[model samples]
Target: MPWFPEFSSAAELARREIRIAGQADPVAQYFTALNEGRTDALEVVWPGEVVIHDPRAGVVRGHRELRTFVQDNRSWLAEHEARIEIMASTVVGPRAVVELLAHVRYDGREVPWPMAVVAESPDDRSVVFRTYCSQWPVDGRRHVRPPVFEPGHAEPGDVVGRHLGALASGDTESILKTFVPDGYVAEPIGPDYIHRGADELRSFYTGTFSEGGGIGLQNCTMIDDGVRCALEYNLIAWGTHAVPPQAGIAVYERSPDGLLAAVRIYDDVEPPDSR
Candidate 1:
């Protein structure tokens, strides 16, 4: 038996319940009952009013339609041994989206099919239960696909390395060049404090780097969308134990000049404050 942990938020709790149970799909029995046309076995864990966001059909407003969708999928189970293989799941606010790739095994054939489901809690607190039995097939052959990476996404390690190199060389101008001019650090629980222009950003880096100590960027993580970029790096200033392990995220937006438009930093932000 898997442990179904409860969450403070009702939606999270419900999502957790489904996740824990589906970890190994013990509820295949429940689906077995439904596929066998036993409506009594269709136990709904939904709240009074639940919203279903299906990737194909858009939004389903009530539990009845959701239940009907459940009823509709019963025939597929009769064709193969269905098991829920969760590919990925993300929880945000009072909602969670689950991606499951169902694997089917039957009659000397196997295939895989993908399905996405979204759960929403009416209030911020709600719990849910989910079961699975749909499956397609998984052929024995492997599919090799080309790797996809954004046009210019730099590894956090490389970025940190370059910044450290600039720090070591006392190249304040180079360090400033790395960050978008108007770059601002993503502050926790507060709005960003803009650094205004490149000169200010250069000053900020020059002051921090010139403290006559070995600095390092640790636990660095970088994320980017073609247009904008983000990075979280820890700043450690060595002398006088002056620098704390300040975990901060920098948000960069490009200017028309192809330079950084703004820079902001939330010095008060802490490590655990980030998700």
Candidate 2:
């Protein structure tokens, strides 16, 4: 079976109970609120608190802010005539990550924007949404996103863990050994930077580890379902240099042979040289 299945539509916002038919994802209510410009449904889904970490809107909390945020987004989407399409969905534990492709008419052209949203339910009442995407599709530059969550002890295991561990070790041979021959790295900015195959992966990692050390990420949360491991982290250091903390999330997909198939990253963190 495929790791990422389509987020089922069988579940309804009005139904709070999780059924064998589908998982009771609060994200459904989130989109519904945005579309209808109403927070009542959202309040029903998550009665206690709704915290959103949005690239454009920053951090939104509580009912009042959520309502305003929803209304504003609804207006913006209506103005831009945005159409969001779900690409894939991965559910693990209490967190569900949904990848979406949104198209908006801009400068007389419809631009495709890719995004991933992590919906984490800590308990039965509260939920947090961390939206990972590049604003470059709309505005031609990367926005520097600051840290959202403090570092925690949520480390990944298995092949996904091996990849991240190799990354921090700055071992090119070790990292390359973890990926399948045809594995690729998909950049967060857009699809234009997909580095595939052994040679391309080697080149990408070589430049990445050139600063004398490997990329260091502090684990904040991890959601793994034995196939795709979704890790939310704070990039604390790159190479020997201790850089400013930046928030990011990555999904590591495992091939059938227990090797990495692909690594999809989502972040707006520009390295020191870029800035």
Candidate 3:
């Protein structure tokens, strides 16, 4: 017997059908198929060129790989008794970022898994899914993830460009200058590991630079929706140690004065010595 039951009512089935037929938003349709474990419905919405960059499974391209990936993911979720609770979603143009809490019952205990997914549509017929999350909840350990996309240059005039510049320069004051006094930064582990306010932010960055003058960013993609800029990059270097670059994404929200108001990061990148 399947853990998620099939649609129970004709009206519900009708709604699902309508949604799968592209009547609803693409991102919503994708999540619907995932939550309901409906591969058929997924096929109706996904184009032939669909690509999935999963943290655990890696990159899966086309319908065949996607089907297998979805099935495997569904099985894993079921095995852990997992349910997704969407925290927030930000849609800018053809890109959508969704933040979710994966509630799972495992090892006779329950835990919340923090994760985020970015969906980008190049055309109506092609879509890319990039997932970001910590692996600790799933396996009781952390695993390094490969870069999802290649790095590109940041536009010199943008806020992200400025932040990167400050970061690379190891100028703590310059980095802090890019953020509002009340801004907060949430590291990849989760919301509870956030560094809030100027004092906390100063302490965090000071230590970061002390270990390494600056870190290198590769394969950078920036998505801006007026209010926020989402940057996906490979964190290649930290401090003195040069380890394999790992995948990470950070969303930067700007204050009214154009300074960074908040930064939420999602990744499983470990310390240099750990590598």
TM per candidate comes to 0.33, 0.86, 0.84
Ranking by TM-score: 2, 3, 1
Of 1 and 2, the candidate ranking higher by TM-score: 2
- The residue-by-residue lDDT of candidate 1 on 117-168, one tens digit each, is 3343444223332211111123322221111112233353434445546655
Determine which window of 10 residues in candidate 3 has minimal summed lDDT: 18-27
Candidate 2 C-alpha lDDT tens digits along 1-275: 45334334334532445321123766666777788888876776677878999988999999999989999999988888898888767897778998777888877788888888988888877889889887887888878778888999987777888899999989988999889999999877667788999999999999888888789999998878788888889888888888788888898989999999999888876665832
| Residue ranges of candidate 2 with Cα displaced over 4 Å | 1-23
Index of the highest-lDDT prediction: 2
- Candidate 2 lands at a TM-score of 0.86
Every candidate's lDDT: 0.43, 0.83, 0.75
* lDDT, model 3: 0.75
Ranking by lDDT: 2, 3, 1
The pairs that clash in candidate 3 are 150-219, 151-218, 151-219, 151-220, 152-220, 212-239
Per-residue C-alpha lDDT of model 3 across residues 1-275, encoded as one tens digit per residue: 55345545665686567644553356666666666666565565554578888888888898888777777777777888888888767787778888788888878888778888888878756778888988776576778898776778645356667887887767788888889888988876655678988899999888777775776667477777777777788988787767688898878888888888887878887765532
Most TM-score-accurate candidate: 2
